[model samples]
Target chain A: MKKNVFTTVTLLARSAGILLFFLYLGKGIQFISHLPIPGSIFGLLLLFLGLNLRLIPLDYVLPTGSFLLNYITLFFVPVGVGLLQYSDLLSTHWLTIVVSSVISTIATLISVGWLYQRFAK
Target chain B: MIYLYLIATILVFLVSRKLLIPIKSPLANPLLVSILFFIGLFSFTPLIYQDYATANLPFIWLLEPAVVALAIPLFSQIKQIKKQFRAIMISCCFGVVIAISTCLSTALLLTDDKILLLSLLPKSVTSPIAMAIANETGGLASLAAAVVIAVGLLGALGGFSLLNLCKITNPQAQGLAMGCSAHAIGTAKAIEVGNEQGAFSSLALVISGILTAVLAPLFAWLIGIIITI
Candidate 1:
């Protein structure tokens, strides 16, 4: 019974944290969507500010946060699978996708690796 | 119908996770496997993306909050992050600029499709930020999301293997390279490698995401692509 209660409370706390985070994100999006900048970026900034201000305790939120991070790719599945709708665009521009992704990723690896070697001492 | 699809997705994920343990190769990633399963399913069935999206919308709504929750980890590492602020900022600026410009130049030289050009701009960033950039830039968010997943898979599958092949032993270097190039999935792999690598990679992911988000638009504007909105 004790273990059950503990698990329930932990689960409740995590769900609450997730809920609050989304509410905050929605408000941030609404505010920044009007501006020239992107709302999600502003939402991230707001999250950063909120954290630095100690408005949200990291310990209480870490479980939910890590949970989300662990399965971040799962969240992208819908959007990714949605690509089927643009099959024609993809087929026509397959080379562009191939070149851009392959080149950019390789470039990123090289540059970041070099910088890390030079400065991360 | 949509409920059945969601159930199928869950089942596929579980099955893939089990199958992956025995194989334990990069190709066995549950995400990639589940996607392939759906791709095959859609190919044979008449199920449209619209129907799948309608079913998947609830799950999709979770992404924004998950991203917001990334602040917790960032907040916990605040002091370490503060001490290395200069290094982080400088590296991020250099990293973001090189990533975007190289991608843009490569895409432009390789193809003239405006939509393809915009889609590739946010490829280095995390998915949510990349999706926003793609949407704002008049590229298909769905396509950008696919590109983001592909980038992540590539980073996870090849990153550690290549690191071993190249004999790059430094945890910091490994973490930063993974996060900078591969984003969250790379960071996940970094964590599996070691603690220090994971911490640094997570830090790099946040900083790199922010930098890419800010720079991609400016780069687009500077290149004379008039903002459609």
Candidate 2:
């Protein structure tokens, strides 16, 4: 029972940390920058800096980070499902979309790999 | 209540995943299956996309925290990141420039529509970043989002064949290529390969997202110039 209570408290603390970072730090920067980039990206940078500065504890953020990352793909499902609304647009340009993405994806993969091997060595 | 929709969505994904356990295809991602399931429901049932989106807002909001949480893995892998910092930066730059230019030029050749061209500009980045950039650049955000997902799914499914064809053996290079090219979904596939690749992929995702955010407008302007020429 004691350990169970401790686990609950830990979960709560971790979640609180995550919320504060996203709601406060992340959104705050977005409000300031007025750039097209999402606030979460700014929040990520702040979190990284905070961690390096020891302002945010690793133990505090690790559980939340890993937990959220594990389900990162799931969170995208709603938006993926949102794709159904675009059936007409997608079908209209299906050839360009498929051909460009496939060709570019392969091109990127090859180029990055080739550059990294050359530069790293 | 909203909880019902949330539960049902998760349930559908779980069921779809379970059903695909025997299939070895990388294309059978939970995101794809769940989206298909939801799309089917929307067609046959009374559910509308707006209602589903509104009901699922809380879960969608979790994406923010997930983004913030990315710092942890990045921090843990800082040593590797620092060691190869220059190479990583250079390769990511190469990847982004190559990705954007190729997609734009090809789309431009296929259609004279500029919005469609802009939508494909940020396709190499993650969905949120792509959507945000698309909106700012006069592209259709919704179309960009869908295109982003399609690019991710395509990369996740067929990326490895390209890697094998290129004979990319270094885990760092592989992760860099995957993340730079495919964004989050590619990173997911990278993680499945190994921890090191996962770290580099995560790094690539963040850096490439930032680069695309900053450079997309400039790239769009350049595309305009090239078109006029």
lDDT of 1 by residue, B1-229 (tens): 5677777766777788778888856677776777777877788888775777788886677666665655555565677667766665666668778878888887887765667778888887777678777887777777776777778777877777676566666766677778888887676666656766666677777778877766776776755553342
Give one digit per residue, the lDDT tens place, for model 2 in B31-144.
Answer: 677887888989888867787888778767887787677677778888878888999999999899999988887887888778898889999888878988998888988888
lDDT at A36, model 1: 30
Q: What is the lDDT of candidate 2?
A: 0.82
Identify the leading candidate in terms of TM-score: 2
- Work out the TM-score per prediction: 0.81, 0.92
CAPRI quality band, candidate 2: medium
Candidate models: Cα lDDT each: 0.70, 0.82
Model 2 Cα displacement at B176 (Å)?
1.6
State model 1's lDDT.
Answer: 0.70
